[model samples]
Target: MESMNIPMRDILQRILKRRKIRPRPGLNYNLEKQEEPGVSIDLDATLASMDTMEFSLVRENSTRRHHNEGSEDEVSTMADSLTSHQYKSYIVSMVHRLRANTDVQLGVSGEKVEVDPVGSKGTKFFKQRAMTYDADNIASCEVLEEKSTGKSVFRITYLISHDYKHSDFEADSEVCNEIVSKINNILELRLSPARKDYVATRAAKHLRKRDSLRDSFRLSKYTDN
Candidate 1:
């Protein structure tokens, strides 16, 4: 009976050995090969290359931005130059118009003075007055010739009142307003809207100078006391 039991145990052991599951020899080896250290390093290099490409793209975008800025500056400079040229042309045209106006007379003459007869022996007096015609309470406009070249230039000379003094309030007088209106009309006919503003500014400066001269003369007359 013991001998039969031992043989049966041996047969069971053989069946268990035949049916047991065993690990495949190459599975771990394949996994280790897939996860090798060098393979991970290669993936890192690929990521670095992608970063470099992105940096180059950003640099190119910055370059285009700088180029656009430079073009905009050039366009602004060209526009300024064109504006300056138009202003110069407008000035020349204004000068030509003033020169061609026939109403502006050209010359310079001395003031006339009347010498009174001697009173009571060796008592004589002289009265001097401007020979120019008076314009409506403002100033007389005259063109005087240059001494050297005979070229005529416009001059604004203030007129003395019948009360024997210069008028201090002529800056805003009707005559000045009429003169400014005439200048504005001439500029409007010859200049564009953009250039008219510049010419008007210059005309205002001239008028300011004339007004300043009038004020100075009035001050001098009073200070003599």
Candidate 2:
């Protein structure tokens, strides 16, 4: 039995050496060659390359952050320069004060004022049409009283010699005063140095964009890769 077992073991060893068994498919197997001997590593060079890559990533992130901050500032500045338009409507005249014109409606927004003629449909063609004016164009706004009826009138005077006098408000005295105050506030805000600077900056930006529209695409050609 021992002699037979020894011969069987020798035969098995020879067969294994001659033909190595292939690994089964769908199995985790490492078939790569072993690492070669005498493969030296330069510690300093490896560290230097890693540091260079890290520095490059930091610089790129910093540049991107700066560009994003600049874009946000530009957007905020542009938004500040724009005017608000939350309009407040007021009944200028509760009753008709003029024979030719009927009641009038006043609308006041951030920096704009609109006056509309409210009359019967039959008289609409002959009545004065609605008009809108900027607060910058208006020189003064005041409440005047008619001598005959003692009713409060909202009057807007332009920078020129023009004056817009609408119908009187027999009951809405406080509303007329509030409208005048709002218009005055808007005018004051427009005259501020910051507001003027923003307006000038926006206008310059528009002009620059317009001038560069044709040549903006050519910038990439001159830029370094």
Candidate 3:
């Protein structure tokens, strides 16, 4: 018996027919070139263009990262400055709040002074309002007593935008004097050299007083013996 050679397509068609899958009867199963030839491509040029695009993308990403980093640093620096300013304001307000005088309702702090006056209707209807003055800008503080009324007036001389300005508050003699003294202390401590000298002088005076007391105590013990 002679063996017969069968096409792969015909075998597949027969298998499909057995499985009840019918192919189009008029369809050609032969493998042949039917369309026009494809155009040739330049592999090297294509690769070079892709490399250039990739390098540009990398450079753009790096530049964006650098810009973001710089913006973050600027924002952080601004936040730090804002925090410092807030802390200074808090310290100023706290100092004024604690030691306010009862009669005048005036308070002095390390950085500023505040005065609260009662309205005609009193504090129940009208909330207490405060006026503030900067200690650093103050050039002078004075208290003057009126002969006719026997009331004391407190005057503050300060600078605003390099121009001299003054604010006046009315209080009794004791309150005015206390406010003036506190303001003067702030002004005197403003200069670093003056503050250092004052501290050194105070320390020397305290040491001398302590030594004198010790000597007196020793002499008293000897006399008792």
Best by lDDT: 2
TM-score of 2: 0.38
Models ranked on lDDT:
2, 3, 1
The regions of model 1 sitting more than 4 angstroms off are 1-190
Each model's RMSD to truth, in Å?
42.3, 32.2, 35.3
Mind giving the per-residue lDDT tens digits that candidate 1 earns over 77-158? 3223212212110010012222222122111111111122222222144222213322222233333332343233433433
- By TM-score, the better pick of 1 and 3 is 3
C-alpha displacement of 112 in model 3, angstroms? 1.0
The TM-score between candidate 3 and the true structure equals 0.33
What lDDT does candidate 2 reach at residue 3? Answer: 21
TM-score leader? 2
Instruction: For each candidate in the order shown, give its overall lDDT on alpha carbons.
Output: 0.29, 0.46, 0.45
lDDT of 2 by residue, 19-87 (tens): 353334553121110122122222223222322111111111122233356555643432222222346
Candidate 1: deviation at residue 67, Å?
65
TM-score for every candidate vs. truth?
0.18, 0.38, 0.33
The parts of candidate 2 lying over 4 Å away from their true place are 1-85, 94-101, 119-125, 146-151, 160-171, 192-225
Report the C-alpha displacement of residue 117, candidate 3, in angstroms: 4.3
Kindly list the per-residue Cα lDDT of model 3 for residues 47-116, writing each as its tens digit.
2232211111111112223335655564443223212211121111112233442333455666566665
Q: Looking at candidate 1, what is the lDDT of residue 60?
A: 12
Q: Where in model 3 is the C-alpha error above 4 Å? A: 1-104, 117-129, 146-149, 192-225
